[model samples]
Target: MRSDGTLSLERRRQEREEAKLLVLRKRGSRLAFEWGLQQCVKSVNATPRLLVYLLREVCVLAGRLARGGRV
Candidate 1:
């Protein structure tokens, strides 16, 4: 970093990804959320329908836990 307060593109991308992870954790995100997102993304044949369904279920579970309800 120079006195100009500018960051390289690679450094900026790493910071952005770190910030995103922080936000997810602050919002009660869990391992299941990460796993579902990663698994679907890694699948070559992943479809919008399946992704939506998986995300929906993850959201519901997270919400339930956040509200102090049993999983």
Candidate 2:
């Protein structure tokens, strides 16, 4: 009986910790998204096409790095 009670208590503690971590993760992602959006909006002559091109270039470079090639 005592062990069962301890296990329940530990389970509750773990659940509370998980909830806190999820909230923190959400807040961090929201902040990052807002920051990136602000930068994109503030850029001069920024367009969807340009953004797509930049993303493609980044992916290409990342692939090269993953293949052990100089980016």
Candidate 1 lDDT? 0.63
For this target, which candidate reaches the highest lDDT against the unseen true structure? 1
User: lDDT tens digits, residues 1-71, model 2?
Assistant: 26555556545654554454446446764443344345457765444543554565567768889999985
Residue 43's lDDT in candidate 2: 61
Candidate 2 to truth, TM: 0.39
lDDT against the true structure, per candidate, is: 0.63, 0.53
Worst 10 residues of 1 by lDDT: 44-53
Tens digit of per-residue lDDT, candidate 1, span 17-65: 4555556656765654574467567755444544664678678988999
Q: Judge candidate 2 at residue 25 and give its lDDT.
A: 41
Q: Give residue 34's lDDT in candidate 2 (0 to 100).
A: 44
Which stretches in model 2 have alpha-carbon errors above 4 Å? 1-45
lDDT for model 2, on a 0 to 1 scale?
0.53
